[model samples]
Target: MEQSSKKSALSEKDGVNQPQSLSNSSVEVIKQMRRKQPSAQELIDGILAKDKVALSRAITLVESTNPEHLEKANTIIQACLPHANKSIRIGITGVPGVGKSTFIEAFGKHITSLGRKVAVLAVDPSSTISHGSILGDKTRMEELVKDENAFIRPSASGETLGGVARKTRETIILCEACGFDTIIIETVGVGQSETAVHSMVDFFLLLKISGAGDELQGIKRGIMEMADAIVINKADGDNIAKAKLAKTEFNRALHLFPAKQSGWIPTAATCSSYTKEGIDTVWKTISDYFELVKTNHYFEEKRQNQNQFWMMETINEQLKSNFYNHPEIIKLLEENKKAVQNDEISPFAAAINLLGKYFKS
Candidate 1:
């Protein structure tokens, strides 16, 4: 009887241990799901669930280039596709001292006061030497950064160009799904190269300094041609007259460049970001823009174009990654570089030969 009792006790002990082991395994699975980027369905469900943290993580995943995360990011994008078209994307750019940050701070606060949510993503060009970002937007937009209705993300140039972050398109999708109606993309104004932001935004606001007539002489005409609305910042006190003068010059210059896009004529105005003067007018102008374009079917067309642009960009990134991933190609490229340096082959010819070798299989 004693032996039988001992056997029964052992069986019960094993049974108890089994549940604990299974529970630990289950907890691990849940943790892993949390650590990974949520699937497209999970992203949509999380948005519906009002899970802001999950939404943010999903955006990060979409921006990541990790070979493992690509499929997950694509699925998340597809899942959130239905809920993604509910927001307005605004691209704002200006030269370094045009007060883009300060203006956004004032402008963003005003938008939130009307009970609308704002998300500002700054795209600062990465320094080639440091291979890191400057991330200056957070320091500049103090009030917007603190506002509950505002989400300000600093620039992430990250070995990319076009003054916008590589993942900004994906980030915008997630933000829109989370019910953010206003999305602002701030770019480092690198002259004509910054036009990449224009391809993605609903409105392109080019901020210029009042005294830029002198500076404009050196600036290219292509940048001015792309502006939908030009705002002269620092339009107060000593700069008022200069700002007005710039407004005239820009208006005259705009007439010379022809209209950009369909049914769009560039408009110029002046604003004092320090006092928040003319900020409301600026917003009203943008609002009027939506009214003008919505009726003409231009708004929808623009969104479709932007989506196409994102797809192309994603494919290009994938191709670049694949090209660099080939060990033989990399070795051949290094060898070809020395040959070119010794004048054995031209750069163009060397590139073609390497590409042919890479694709020969």
Candidate 2:
């Protein structure tokens, strides 16, 4: 009786000592998942097989600064390269109040509705100062985040802005290899970030709000010039008339800018993320632009030119990183910087001196 009671009772004496629920194979699988970082070939095969886990790991490798992972990262990228350039890279930028998050979520859902895989990459400001992202948009993107057809990632933190951009560009390749057809890059802040994103994307969309009174106050001329389409958001209910007026103003302003080299004219439109109105029209505009560029052969040419430009940019980034990280140059840089600050040496002369020493070393 005592033995039967001990055996049947769910207590530490029996249950804890010999838990039937803890399967050995399950434990081993969990341990395996935790223990191994997948190799480059494994990552490549997984990405090609459309595994998001593999794609995410490959991106982490690309973002890693550990010198040891560089070759492995390069291997993954080279393997993924042929599978890239098949997706359309779109960059969306706007000022803080423009509702970029809501717009993107709605836009992404629409794209996924068409049976296309979408990846949204954000260039958030906080990632620069803090290694971790502080994008409120991520939480706001609940629906899109839950969608299996969509993947969203914030900017990877880096020692320099160029490094951040480079990591993102590399991430694009991985996403493409993973079978994402539409890549949307969101610039979370204004300024040079827009320019950096513009270089990497095929379509540059500028989102704005209506009823600002001035219709164009606080908007940068350079941003307007770069815009392939200027979309006025919040165009619903009582704001509809205001949005239409703002759209007309933007159209007039776009006309003032010189013709784009692609020979594609910029367009102005309006959309409401709340109602999801005009979203299809915006996508149609993008499709029309792609058709035009592709038919004129400018699409491939632009991508080729961008590839060359980023190649040089990569070289510059590497050279600068190597020069500053060099032990001898690091010591001299501080001395030279202080000397220039104290007026003991000209800034240009100090720069030349550093370069001369760098090349000699």
Candidate 3:
């Protein structure tokens, strides 16, 4: 009888462990379901409802290189097109270590406080060897991450130039569709990245710092010309005097440039992100810019041009892909490359030969 009782107790202990195993299995099943690819309608509905999970999935789908995902991503974008173009798109660029992330955190929190939904599409540098992103933006913008009205996405990993991701333009449309009143795209801050950002945004903000010496520490002159507003960040404590001087210098520099097409002068402001000082002045500058451009009809015209530019860019990208991805062209390229390298053929001849093979294939 004692042996039987002991056996029964052991059985009960095993039963208790079974529930724990079952619980883990159930959790995993739920995770698998979430990981399962969602349908186009499901993604679109979730995005329209401002579901963060769905919005993130949709962005991943758009960034995917898989053919099936690409098709679905296109469908989702097409469905959301009508709901887009309602938000103001702003592009922020600056050299690295200029406190871009800190300034954005302060600025984003301020924007969200005004009851506006803000989305930050921050682009981070990718490793050339691994082809992966550093993904440090999310960690940097702690305050904005906690804000209910703000959404911050780290840079996607893939081919990029001038620090702007290839699919950023499409991502902007998705953000706008998600009912975000303000969309901010933060570029990788390299000089070339500014041009790409400028083409997509209503307002291009060039973030600068004080005491950077005469050449502005390698910032391209062309980038300065593209700015709609120049903001000097980190203007607290000992930096305040230098910031004011920098602001004055920038204001004088703007006067030397020809007037903008919108007939609005690019303005300069100084701000301290840590203390939240002068943040409002930056917002006011952006607001005043929108009013001026809208009044003169430049806003609509610029968007129209941007659309046309993207259309051509898409075509160019597709043509290049088609040619390079062709099987015969791939084989011919290898042969022609070796021939040119060995002095067996001229570079031009090799290129023409490859083109002929590509067209025939």
Candidate 4:
């Protein structure tokens, strides 16, 4: 009877030990298994949790064309929608050697000093001949980029026109969603065809050098007329007089142009990026412009329109990509190119035929 009682006790111990072993094994299995992908809410929570690393990764996903990440990116963007629209979007552009980067660093430093966050995006146009971009602008923005409150992203324009990457507009949305509060987009100083940036940004700032007479001569009227504010850079020491003269000329030139969509008049001022002088004046003008537009109730309306514009642009980009990727369309384009080379069809006719064939159901 004692032996039977001892056996019963052993059985009871085994029963409890078996369950404990299984429980430990189950946990080990769970730990070895791949973690389930995070939901959009989870992603946003991670971002709001002040996870800078997560924010950086999320922005990368949004900028990516990876098929696997696109859905996740879209979801994250949706979650971030409500928390967005709290930032000021500024577009800065100038010809080469106009101290664009210097001014930006100075300007960015000034903004962040007020305890606001600034995100600067450099748009480097892709070189047609080499299929590469010389992304040197960010290197010049050393001081601002080092600031804890500043984030800098340099994007390759790739075959996109307008001196900006096609994804730049989308990137702006993501940045604003991240609580940046101030977003600055710097475009490759393409003399003209940069109005695309103007449409997307609240303030369009044009930077000019003091002695760019020949360079400015080549600039088209449309870009000049599109500017909300013109900044004559390099206004230090010997060039101060020339900078002052350029400012006067620009001010006079601006008067001849019509008002912007915001109905705000563009102002021209001189500044020395090297010395950081006149930087405050530039910011003050921007502040004044914001006050004027906000008071007129044009600020909100302008932002709404910009959002709609970007939506249409995004759709068009997707459709274009799809149309080009279709197998039959690709073959048709190749055949059309051969026909054009053989003089069997006119260039215009081939284009029409290819487009019609692709679109025909």
Across 83-112, the per-residue lDDT of candidate 4 in tens digits comes to: 778888899998877877889999999999
> Which prediction has the highest TM-score against the true structure?
3
Off by over 4 Å in 3: 1-23, 214-220
Measured by lDDT, the strongest candidate is 3
Q: Tens-digit lDDT track for model 2 on 179-283?
A: 999999987655667777888899999998887654757245877888899899999999999999898888887878889999999989999999999999999
- What range of 10 consecutive residues in model 2 has the weakest lDDT sum? 156-165
Q: Looking at model 3, which ten-residue stretch has the lowest summed lDDT?
A: 12-21
Q: What would the per-residue lDDT of candidate 3 be over residues 212-291, giving only the tens digit for each residue?
A: 76325523468878999999988999999999988888888888887899888998889999999999999999999999
Candidate 4 clashes between residue pairs 3 or more apart in a chain or in different chains:
none
Ranking by lDDT: 3, 2, 4, 1
Return whichever of 1 and 2 wins on lDDT: 2
In candidate 1, stretches whose alpha carbon ends up further than 4 angstroms from where it belongs are: 1-44, 212-215, 218-220
Poorest stretch of ten by lDDT in candidate 4: 12-21
lDDT of candidates 1 onward, in order: 0.80, 0.86, 0.88, 0.81
Regarding lDDT, does 1 or 4 come out ahead?
4
